[model samples]
Target chain A: MTKNLSNVNQIIAKYQGDQSALIQMLLEIQRENRWLPKPVLARLSQKLGIPISQIYHIATFYKAFSLIPQGRHTVSVCLGTACHVRGAPRLLDRVTDTLKLNPGETSVDYKFTLKTVNCLGCCALGPVMVVDGEYYGKPSAKEIEKVIANCD
Target chain B: MKKLQKVTLTINDREVTAKEGMTILEAARDAGIYIPTLCYHEKLAPYGACRICTVELSRNGRSRLVTSCVYTVENGLIVKTESPKVIKVRKLLLELMLASSPAKAIQDLARQYGIEKRRFEADKTNCILCGLCVRYCSEIKQANAIGFVGRGTERRVVFHPEIASTVCASCRECFSLCPTGKLPSETDGVCFDDLTLDDFLKTQQSPA
Candidate 1:
């Protein structure tokens, strides 16, 4: 319990515990821990004077937050108009086959999370597969497999 | 002497007056203006979930659609309960309601607006997330056993996994208010108590 308190306090101090910074604090915690633990969220609610239900509402309202465990790599395939016309669905299938995950699901090994995004605003890079910060444009099966092997 | 404050506004090009702190819906109803709504109840607090009571407000020429159930009255607020834009928003919302539940209540409401078919595929989850049941449980019964869980397309009204059993046995106020409720028979909470992740998956597997 003391360890949890100190960990939460360290995070709270990093942003000076601003009320408006709750979302950002949750995001940073998600990045570090790969998910928002219930205990961590409770600590945040207590420290921020926010109701746990409200915090849960906010966390669930946004697509960015995840309460359950997440994989190390966030892999997203664009299925927007441009990507669709350029064969984004097939590319998504190939990536999913390589990682053994379906859309809106993470791999059992916790290495990669496979998801489908509407658009990434980079239509020029049609058929885009974003593995975290790295964007792969028009990637073929061989390229996706290589990317999968490279994933930690 | 404490006197009630009064406010006047123009709704649908007709001058209407109402007391201050009254919602636009109440004022419009008093003025005999017909505004469609689904998630509103007189006994409970205003819930803008259904978005069917949206109206166009043109205050100072900045027109925007606002839900009448929650938007309060202010003097000089130009309200259009059946403006073209307002109708369009209501039509979209009704189609969504149709998608959620095709019960007689939903169908009867849609038929009033000449809506016979749904433009989009019916999700068929049957529960529209109106929060009527949740609100009734909390406010009237003081039982917080049910609430909104998850997010986005994965969102749904659900009994809290741990608390739905003991507290919800005798409470059926929400059931009466639910547009598509079919649970809580004489056994009471027997169905909701067995809600597992598998049940959630089964609902998700249904064509949405």
Candidate 2:
């Protein structure tokens, strides 16, 4: 809803018309807005003079970027080797059941977005999850229910 | 050589200057401030996989938490590397990382932090906390030798569907880089040339 292109324009200006900063600038904008809309990408394309296809390509290339809407809370489950052997699949099942949505999907109320990551580099805590960038380790299906309840 | 632009930033109340495009970790180290980090080596680009180097930065009246390894230095930036909030967050992040990785090194670090047993249930997975396997396979190796499959709790790193040696070199690069000994040897001739998904899974069950 930040329709006033002032901030976005300001960001563009700060980069000194460098199109290379496109991805970085987009990341900053998305961080503030939560999700990138088509209009914003088009605006970026117009300002940077880059093709919308190229912009979309770069956006899709990075796992961090998302074209669809994301929830207020982002839940990232680590699916590294350690977590996998430790029954991470079961944990994921629990999360899906509780949230009533699979990975890469958002909850019905738009409160949570569930994602699975390869590794968070915190293998010490197998079966790890990051809720809104806050790490939660060694969670059980039952424990996940409590965690989700606490989030509410 | 063209001199890189240098920028001054404050980290944990200490003023430090570093070359433009340098990560917050490099800047903090140049300023003699120690910020614990894993999965970050001076020889490599910042991967931002490990959440241990999370720091709070304030620039132009706006503050945010970011991984110092991936965050670049900006002029007139204010950073807090160590504080109660940061410590708490770091502790939790480390704890979470530990739960997934049951490597001895990870456990040793946990002990240093006074965490004897994990607060959360043990994941009992074979993924060691070290990110070498993932990093080498994805970034340096460019083989995508393995990748995370599934989502949410079911997420895991595995050879692509119909795992074939054509997709993987079986060069043992991942095995060497793995901090844990989870990667099995490829001496079995099956992975030497090309392997099918069934062959790979069967290999995992029976080692070379």
- Highest TM-score, which number? 1
Docking class of 1: incorrect
lDDT of 2: 0.68
Per residue, candidate 2 scores C-alpha lDDT tens digits across A18-131 of 999998888877776666676787778788987554565466556676666778888888888999987777777888788877777776687988888898888888788888
Q: State the lDDT of candidate 1 residue by residue for B1-208, as single tens digits.
A: 6786999999989999999899999999998998887788898899898888999999667999998999999999999888889777777777887887777777877777767656787776677788887787767776566666666767766565345566666655577787765443322562354444335534432322
Per residue, candidate 2 scores C-alpha lDDT tens digits across B1-208 of: 8889989888777678899988888888887898887677665567787678888887667777888888888998888987666777777876886777766656665666666546876675555344565456556766554554223443344453223255454466566555444555322312322433234333322211
Error of 2 at B130 (Å): 6.6
DockQ for all models: 0.20, 0.03
Score each candidate by Cα lDDT: 0.77, 0.68
Error of 1 at A115 (Å): 2.3
TM-score of each: 0.74, 0.48
Model 1 lDDT on a 0 to 1 scale = 0.77
